[model samples]
Target chain A: EAGVAQSPRYKIIEKRQSVAFWCNPISGHATLYWYQQILGQGPKLLIQFQNNGVVDDSQLPKDRFSAERLKGVDSTLKIQPAKLEDSAVYLCASSLFIGGAVKQQFFGPGTRLTVL
Target chain B: DQQVKQNSPSLSVQEGRISILNCDYTNSMFDYFLWYKKYPAEGPTFLISISSIKDKNEDGRFTVFLNKSAKHLSLHIVPSQPGDSAVYFCAAGGGTGTASKLTFGTGTRLQVTL
Candidate 1:
């Protein structure tokens, strides 16, 4: 089966500019997530969507970052007025949610955003 | 604060030897732990996992052990292969409504040499 897909494997933008990343999850997956991985650090959860509805986004920076999954299949994460600290890889993941069980999350190659 | 931590930055082991990676978590609410393997320029892939209800789970050459009282966990790879060189991340999940939300640690890089 095909795995999660993301676009523009790499991106570069100037500080204060805006950037957007896209993600298309695996087929039939009910849950999607966005994460940020800074250099030498593990991926940090940014937001989660369960069928186009947000499940969690407490860690997201509302002042600069936003995400949406309109059709519950593909998602987009946007950062406005990007700062140098926002330079990191943006990873997208998806999982099949079945009640209370913890499902395995499949990840995409990720978009590397470099803010100069 | 970091809820999950993999203190080792790197490890090198000869092929055919056993590799052990350790992880510690500070959150008592975490009941499920997982390990993910990642290559440079690639996203992390699920490797193995264990639930808090069990102390050990094994799959082929990989085994995961969880010590609830110590809030620690470990992943063991036996007869390690060169292809096993990658960054390994430990992640934990649990809570009332956020059971699917995972908190990850800064990974440990393992190199299997011949």
Candidate 2:
């Protein structure tokens, strides 16, 4: 089966500029997630979507970052006025949610954003 | 605050030897633990997982042991292969309404040499 798919494997933007990343999760997957991985650190959860509805986004910086999954299939994460500290890899993951049971999450290659 | 931590930043082992990576978590709410392996420029892939009820779980050459009292876990690879070289991350999740929300460790880089 095909795994999660992301676009623009790499991106470069100047500080204060805006950037967007796209993600298309595995077909039939009910849960989607966005994460940020800084150098030498593990991936940190940014937001989660359960069928186009947000499940969790407590860690997301609302002042600069936002994400949406309109159809529950594909998602987009956007950052406005990007800062140097925002330079990191953006990873998208999906999993099948069954009766609230924990499932393995399949990840995409990720989009590396470099803010200069 | 960092709930999960992999204190060892890196480890090197000769081929055909055993490799052990350790992880510690401070959150008592975590009841499910998972290990993921990642290569450079690639996203992490699920390797193995264990529930709190089980002290040990093994799949082929990879085994994960969880000690609830100590809030520590470990991954052991026997007869390690060169292909096993990658960054290993430990993740934890549990509690009501947060089973799917995982907290990950900083990761431990492991290299196998021949």
Listed in order, each prediction's TM-score against the native is: 0.97, 0.98
Expressed as tens digits, the lDDT of each residue in B19-76 for candidate 2 is 9999999999998889999999899999998888899999999999999999999999
* Regions of model 2 farther than 4 Å from truth: B96-99
Model 1 residue B31 distance off true place after TM-score fit, in angstroms: 0.3
Index of the highest-lDDT prediction = 2
**Global CA lDDT computed for model 2:** 0.93
Docking class of 2: medium
Can you give the DockQ of every candidate in the order shown?
0.62, 0.65
- Candidate 1: CAPRI quality band: medium
lDDT of 1 by residue, B1-114 (tens): 999999999999999999999999999999888899999999999999887889999999999999999999999999899999999999998763333789999999999999
Which residue pairs does candidate 2 place in steric collision?
Answer: none
**Candidate topping DockQ:** 2
TM-score of chain B of 1: 0.96
